[model samples]
Target: MAIVLRYVDSLDFVKERFIGIVHVKDTSSLTLRNAINEVLTSNKLSFSQIRGQGYDGASNMRGEFNGLKALILQENDTAFYVHCFAHQLQLVVVAVVKKYDGVSDFFEQISLVVNVVCASCKRKDLLREQARERVQKGLCSGDLETGRGLNQVTTLVRAGETRWGSHFNTLISLMKLFVDVLVVLDFVKEEGGSLANRQQASGILAYFKSYEFVFYLHTMYDILHLTGTLSKQLQRKDLDILEAASMVRGTMEALQSFRNIGFAIILPKICNLQNIGIDLVKQAPQLLEYMAALSPCDSFAQFDKSKLLKLGKLYKYDFDDSDMIDLEGQLGIFYHSCIKDERFTSLKGISDLSRLMVSTGKHRDRKCRKMFSKLKLLKTDLRNKIGDEFLNDALLCNVETEALTKVEDEKVMERFEKMYAQRGQI
Candidate 1:
């Protein structure tokens, strides 16, 4: 387990600092809790100091009764939990969509076809030759414009399962070179040197020509296009929670709109969408709501004083009753102070607002969201599937297993001995 702390400094500027890492025996909640306490004790930080927890939507981390979130909350009730935003995005678009057999099979066949076409020098050359001929035909028919560097032909890029961009590019390349890909597959099927190669080509050709594949290809292309912008924005280092929420809401609206019109247009072939994004929430609703209430968009048009006060109440250890009482009045004064002040006129996010508050001597105040991209990068497009520790891997340097075991053995084993009540088992 790794921890990246999002905390305010003396200057009240929000900072993300990489913190301690613990490689536990396993990811069970009890083990995680022990590891967490071990890190906190080493740093002289306390359980009471934790005001929030965010993890990806793994059952081990976010499970209602036994997750790490629940385990921590049991020790300290103030440590509320929220699911990771980017993981929620992948849930809605990539992971959920692939649950459908047609969509699943579509991607499977695409991988097979790309592999076959790029298997050797001769077959790859055939693809480029076909693509060149396609551009030539398009140019002659007035379907494509001549340009200095516009029509350069290239081989198809195979989609990587972990990259939405790669999947999108594969869809675009397939659409552009649909006829060309078909030609290559046909030649291999009829005149290939090996029977196994011919059989594979024949099966792929049959699958590609099926109505199911074509529908899935075009449908996923549109859905991915709709989601592409939000996905990029979510990964941006500068993105704050408020802007992310807005973009997420916008993406959901786009998806809903697409469903309304897209299904209407293709109502006749709408049988296989049973498992695509059945219950996707952009993120935990409570998290979005709490964060959304703190937005400074449109000169604090969305700011809710009551909700902002609730934030302080959420972290009561950091804010007492006097602070809360003072906060209620401060909220009103800050709103006008910011509105009348020209320095805060163009502010559209919480991070910018936090910084402005500090610069203007409102410093006695504070507080997050861009590290999920780092988490995603750790998942790496090469993995067969993203494991539960994707969040843990991002924030801390990997500890050498031998050193980690030796370094933390006493504390961990002592804790386990106390918990298990069998001292001699060690």
Candidate 2:
């Protein structure tokens, strides 16, 4: 178990510290609670000082009853639980992709393609050579642009179950090196040492050449590419929940827009690969619904209470009961009360100042310029009130250091010398 502490320093900058990791026998709530308490005790801290707790959406961690979060809250109710946003986004992608049969099958086939082509070093070398030849041909014909780091030899990347961005990279590599992949598969089908190997290659090659597979491949590439961008943005160390929420809503809106008009946008590219069109009208709605529903829980953050109530009323035609009415009423009351509180109305978390600084630097709006001037004055006042040493310490509080012995330094130098000698030989 890992323990992290977040705090605002004298400079009003948000900082995170890694306390330590605790080894536990099991992941039961009791065990986790005890481990956390032990770490707190050893560090001379108390549970009352904690203001927030974050964890993945696990039953043992975030359950309302008999969970680690619940136990912590029992001790100090102020330590509100914030579920891991990145993990939630990852789960959303995984669930949505697997919920659709066509998209799911596309992923499975891509995985198989990677595994088959990279099973042997001979096949890998052949792929590299073929990719090199294609790049050279394209360069000579002036069909492809050549520059630094452009048109390099391509390799198949295996898709990972946990990392959604890897799927995007795999799809892109496959599309870029489509011909080379087909050539390698064809070679394996004909010259394989065993009948079973040849048959497997033949099956994969046929599937790779299918129109249905090609269509889904391009379609999923477009979809995953968008979500993959969101996943990367959410992983940034400086991002705050508000910015992350805003990004999530923007991505959902983009996806909805794509669902309505993406066929026309993607069809031209698909036709370039194969001069055929498959009817997707009957099959697209379900996939679009699944994709739109991926982050339903986070979608609510996009709207104000009034808009939400209006949306609930507008969608009442689909529901034949009063659940929508009850939901809207409850949401109206909750948000109405929360909006009146000063804490909810004026609270700007850690990322606000940094975001303002960026806006002031990049934008030339009157409000932004005035806000930047006020921010500069505030910084000067704070620096004068709190000495420079305190601000310096706050900046350097998270820096970790280690002492290197003389013998270790010599070992590093010797290793570098050996590497240099080997490089000369090469």
- Structural similarity to truth (TM-score) of each candidate: 0.74, 0.64
Residue pairs with backbone overlap in model 1:
none
Per residue, candidate 1 scores C-alpha lDDT tens digits across 10-112 of 6666666666446689989889888888878898997888877888777888989999899899889888886667656766666665556677777888889
Superposed Cα deviation of residue 58, candidate 1 (Å):
3.5
The deviation in Å at residue 55 for candidate 1 is 3.2
The CA lDDT of each predicted structure is 0.74, 0.65
Worst 10 residues of 2 by lDDT: 362-371
Tens digit of per-residue lDDT, candidate 2, span 6-31:
77654445776655445689999999
Model 2 scores a C-alpha lDDT of 0.65
TM-score attained by model 1: 0.74
